[model samples]
Target: MNADDAAADQLPLIDQEDRLMASLVPLAGCRLVEVGCGPARLLRQLLQQVDGLECAALEVDRVQLARNRSEPVCPGLHFIEASAAAMPLPDGWADGVLMLKSLHHVPLDELDTALDEVARVLRPGGWFYVSEPIYAGALNALIRLFNDEGVVRAAAQAALDRALARGRFTAVSEHRFAQAVAYPDFDSFEQRMMRPSFADHRLTPELIAAVRQRFEPHCGPQGARFVRPMHVRLLRRR
Candidate 1:
């Protein structure tokens, strides 16, 4: 889906987190932390599911955090402004940690440190769950055609695999969720794709126009649709 459509049709806060939390049911009653929680959507929903289950979210961007302050805080929910590389919590404090759709922004060189931090904060037998996009098939070709520079989809998969191998966590489950988002029309699609956050590096007027042209033929009269594969994994500290 293009930016406006994405924003307008954004997943309902509770539904989105419920899907993620469903996979973590085994860890119910354990303290949970969410890293890189943008807009606090998932964090807000997570707080509703379990009573007295300590829930906290860490966001690196103060500006985003400030905007979230306008929203009422839920009971047992806490928001912290901090970097993922150096979580403020003491070691072995969290029984489960989550990072969803934010890993791509992390620099490749610092990935190890990020994983190290996740490993450090999690208690033995704790769970680390992550859900991220894994561009492949037609989507990979489309990204290459659009000259997207966010993350090499393949590299992201490889890095996560390597991190699991070297870090103290052991993989328990890996699943792929196919998400298809549709835009109302070309204009809507363009507006969404051109968001500063989505296309900060490689977005150009010419490239945007080209992408529109390339996907235009495929778009139904109503709008264009893009299918992207999302990767979800659950890991446990060994």
Candidate 2:
């Protein structure tokens, strides 16, 4: 077993950003790219805390991209509308590439090409941070009710392992942690999770009702809170 396979369930709950920042300290002042950045919430936080860090945030959703660009632009931060399979960035330009719970969303057929794009953009010894949601968890069970990701999620890991076996990257570390996810009610969950702009999760009336039936059980006055288990793999370019 490699160091990247270290057990994570035994570890206590902690903020994902805290774990990420600990490893990112060395990359301050270096170039970083976040694929499928979505709202770039974490990138905003990183820009605020890390000095001189240049960031390229890429997202495939044009609607979301417009919103991200409409927000105040931070120094050294650029937003691009792009996919992981074909990043427009130049070769060996980034010190680090991050995929925060986004790899599994890539088309299964393009997984290899996407990883190749990541490897292509990262300089030798550059880091690749992949944060994927673990298949087991209360939140995952609920999400799986409508949008089952078992196949894609498993494919994401398998692609990573293949890349490693091919000497594309050296395994560095693996971390598992549970993140706190809260939904003020079923509507909040439906709007955010079910109606995301990136993909069409076709929700018929029957499907919506079915999802609500399962989700309502977890709701209370303040709302439903579930711990989302996450698997983070850190690798270095070979």
TM-score of each: 0.78, 0.93
lDDT of 1: 0.70
Encode model 2's per-residue lDDT on 100-183: one tens digit a residue: 999999999999999999999999999999989888766777898889999999999999999999889999888777778899
Query: Which pairs of residues collide in model 1?
Result: 3-192
Q: Give the number of the best model, judged by TM-score.
A: 2
- Which stretches of candidate 1 lie above 4 Å from their native place? 1-17, 137-152, 197-199
* Count of clashing residue pairs in every prediction: 1, 0
Cα deviation of 184 in candidate 1 (Å)?
A: 3.1
TM-score of 1: 0.78
**Worst ten in a row by lDDT for model 1:** 6-15
lDDT of each residue in 1-117, candidate 1, tens digit only: 555334433333222545655755554576888888877677666667655678778888776778767687677778898777889999999988988877765667767788788
**Best of the candidates, lDDT:** 2
